[model samples]
Target: MGLGKTLQTISLLGYLHEFRGITGPHMVVAPKSTLGNWMKEIRRFCPVLRTVKLLGNQDERKHIREDLLVAGKFDVCVTSFEMAIKEKTALRRFSWRYVIIDEAHRIKNENSLLSKTMRLYHANYRLLITGTPLQMTRLLDILEDYLMFRAYQYCHIDGNTGGEERDAKIEAFNQPGSSKFIFLLSTRVGGLGINLATVDIVILYDSDWNPQVDLQAQHRAHRIGQKKEVQVFCFCTEYPIEEKVIERAYKKLPFDALVIQQGRLAEQKTVNKDVLLQMVRFGAEMVFSSKDNTLTD
Candidate 1:
């Protein structure tokens, strides 16, 4: 998961600042646990950009807004998805150049208020960053497609269509002058949607384990509408857990089974005891295995 998504986000922000001359108020929405991580990344990469973290209660939000509006004071604003939903009214008041959604999968549920709130806001540019873009279900695919390309009408061509037919349709739709509605940086989720004529670039990172994960990751960028010859970058390190997970997924094992196997392997390798114990506890909970089954015991 340490795929430099944060660094890429910072680079995009820097590009906007330097190339596009976009110094307007910008916002980044991420999970609560990652707000500090984002701030750290921004400071490390783009120190010149001013930032305000939206946290605390009503008064805190007011203060954040006041500080942001001050003439030439702050350039960017960062907040958690929770806060963004809570303070949607206040957030909409400020005109934003870019609204970046980190772990955009959080809003994969199209019906969630978080997704609704995000869609309501007006931003000159919207960027979504995530390692696992299609975590929940195929519904996520639709939502992300809409968000990235603003696709108004989307429907499966046919469930029984052969790969050749599917490719032909995608090719036709992705032809030049079709629509400039969507740009995708997906992994497996984009395989069915990848248009070589439309996709600009793709970057692949190596970790260890799952074929499904690997397949999905590649499909994200290797799609049909990609007009330019795709550029793919693969990154790998000694840590092989990610690769292991991918391999297991390819074997058709349930994710839970793979996790248990991984845990056992880690324990065999003398991995952290606490982490192992945590995995054991997790497994016990999954099977509802308990030391004290009786309510009073």
Candidate 2:
């Protein structure tokens, strides 16, 4: 976990400014807890550039927005997910040179309030930091990330319930001890930004393509502000595709699942290339050979 990502990022920002001649009024959207570290690193390493921490009470934040938007005073702005949404009216005014997100899982679900609002911020270059592989060489690596996010909205049904309905659900779910509230929600929409900390348990009625969405659903109750220990449950039927989803996730991250879920890692290996080809061929053959929806294994 301690991969020196912050140091490396500060290095890149400095390099781009000094040698590449890309003097940026960049934006960094990070967790409230880590916004200090982002600005601190920039100051400690790249002190020449003026960095502003976009936080404060409502009034202070309003003034900071004027500085960044109207005055265009700072070289970089470090803000949290909440402030990005709250300040989007001003944040949208200037096109950013870079929009970097720390712990990008915050916006893993595209239609979530914070996720959508972050996009309204125009950025010439976008960056996301996740626990996944980090290669500082690629700044445009965010294009794949952007595609994946947009694809999720199209794939998840309840994720499309944008605007007021989504806000109402978040508010209701965050209330302390809301009894008899059976919130039927999509895996993506139910996961991001909302303070589901008061929720005692979370039920994932189905899985999403990215295992991250599945993990996000379970963490809804596991976050800060929760009164009781949270329990997470996921259900999948006998479908082959459903079984494959879980198997692949556990296989890819056996150690993470072991600690996080308190489950043992099943002995797993890579699927054979020939076997994968056979599965693909079988699906194609079934589609052409029969009208039946079920493919016989």
Candidate 3:
């Protein structure tokens, strides 16, 4: 959640206005919880860009729509998803230079109302931002189906979960004799500001590319006051891209330790083309040569 998507988007807008001469009527749609953060980042990074928020009751919205929302007056308009939907008609009146959606997976399903409404507007360019990748979201869908078929009680937390709702979910899961059996969460969101000391078992259905993130998720169940010994299980396939990813994570752990214990600055590491090629080609030969049928359905 702290990967600087907000700052990156702000920089892009600033570039467009400063260099490209595209002083837009750009629109950014995000969750209600993040609108403040977005505004703060914009003001801190790009004060020259004019901004407006489309929020409030009908009268207030009417006043903004009638007065402050004139095109050319503002460079960026930030609003929540609810406001975007409610004020879609008025918003559609502008020929937007850019339409950016934060946590864009909300519209993954084209049939959903939000998706349909987003497409109704006109924008020269559209950008979608999300911490969860496409494959990760699809995997979650499969996990949901499996959990539902097993009739297990579970809760989910992602970028869109508000602070109150997130706390309620954690409290429910941690309660004594609670029926909630599993807590499904993306590593990025779950790795931050969560404590589940009552949990004794942590099953990592997937791993984050960053080893520290995976460690954080494991610590959620292994917190202080836990009576039973916490057990962590990490899921990984052999010789695929993930195997290489896990290897890279392990290599970085030593450097991370140095940074933590010795106050040494750790250089930021990135995977290059050779490593990427190896990751892509890692298991190909084995899969093509094997004759075994692994399917069981």
Candidate 4:
């Protein structure tokens, strides 16, 4: 609850602007509930960097879109996904220094219009964050699916487990010197608020739309009270949808040697129309056919 991710981000933006001399018209797209929080964080952390929340009536918002976004009059701009889509053309024109997304469920489904629209905006760096679990069941890779059956490793947490069953799994995970390897979890189920500091490694079998949820899961083992230095891994397939998901999920991350990734941050776009059609068709069929289909198209 007290996590200061907002402050951390402000620090990064400030560092890039002040120390590196890379002044930016950075952008932050968050859910409406938290948009004000982002603005507040900006004022608290880096007041030196002027900012604006992209809102108001069409005329007022349009004025910012055409004038401020182009002139870089503001250091950073915050808006909701609704605003991003409603005002795409105007927002897309300017090449942004960085684009940060909060409650980033929109990008989870590559076929989703919001996801596709988000990819059109040009930025040197992209950051995606979400507060809840987004659609994780994207189009499945037949080849990857086949490989899963042949694989011998993994511990997955089902969504329906009761308190006792869930606690057992958590206990086993945190017991002294356990030998378990790969761990899998539903984002909504296990990625909310749990501690698993015994394990030294984590693999997000599926990426959640919310970066915060994913962070919560990753910290299961790597958070406070963990004895060993942890290693975290996330998977991104080569398919266009999968690739976009991966790109948004990891773009905000800093490199091992460098504190931040700088230069040539191009926004991702949809691939061939043919591939997109096939995926949408397949995903739609899957959704309609199964009563329990939880996969997001």
Choose the strongest candidate by TM-score: 1
Task: Name the better of 3 and 4 by lDDT.
Answer: 3
Model 2: residue 204 alpha-carbon error in angstroms: 33
User: Whole-model lDDT, candidate 2?
Assistant: 0.67
**lDDT per residue (tens digit) for residues 96-190 in model 4:** 99999876666778899878888999998997655454544322232235447867333445565577777777777666765445455666665
Q: Model 1 Cα displacement at 250 (Å)?
A: 19
Give the least accurate 10-residue stretch of model 3, judged by summed lDDT.
288-297
Model 2, span 1-297: residue lDDT tens: 676778877887888889998777888888899988887789899997778888999889877766554434677888888888887887787778899888887776778998888878888888887766342212223433554665531111154567677677667656655542444555666566655666677665556656677777777677777779776766655544665665455444433443565433234345457755664454356434534443232
lDDT of 1 by residue, 1-297 (tens): 898888877887888788988776888999999989888988989997888888878887787768654547778888999999888888888778899998987787889989989999899889888888453344445555666585453323424457776666566656667653433333444445544445555444332244455455555555554445666544433233443443344344344555657766765765566765665565334323433321111
- Residue 121's lDDT within candidate 2 is 81
Model 3 whole-model lDDT (C-alpha atoms): 0.82
| Ten-residue stretch with the least lDDT total in model 4 | 253-262
- TM-score, one value per model: 0.50, 0.46, 0.49, 0.46
Badly placed stretches (over 4 Å) of model 3 are: 136-297
Candidate 2: stretches off by over 4 Å: 68-72, 132-297
Q: Write the number of the candidate with greater TM-score, choosing between 1 and 3.
A: 1
Please report how far candidate 3 places residue 283 from its true position, in Å.
18
Tens digit per residue, CA lDDT, model 3, 1-297? 887789989999999989998889899999999999888889999999999988889999999998899977888999999998999999999999899999998998989989999999899999998887766556666687799999999988877789999999999988999899888888887779899988888877777788899888888887777999887766768754666676576556655665585533334255457755654554354334445422111
Q: What does each candidate score in C-alpha RMSD?
A: 15.2, 16.7, 14.7, 22.3
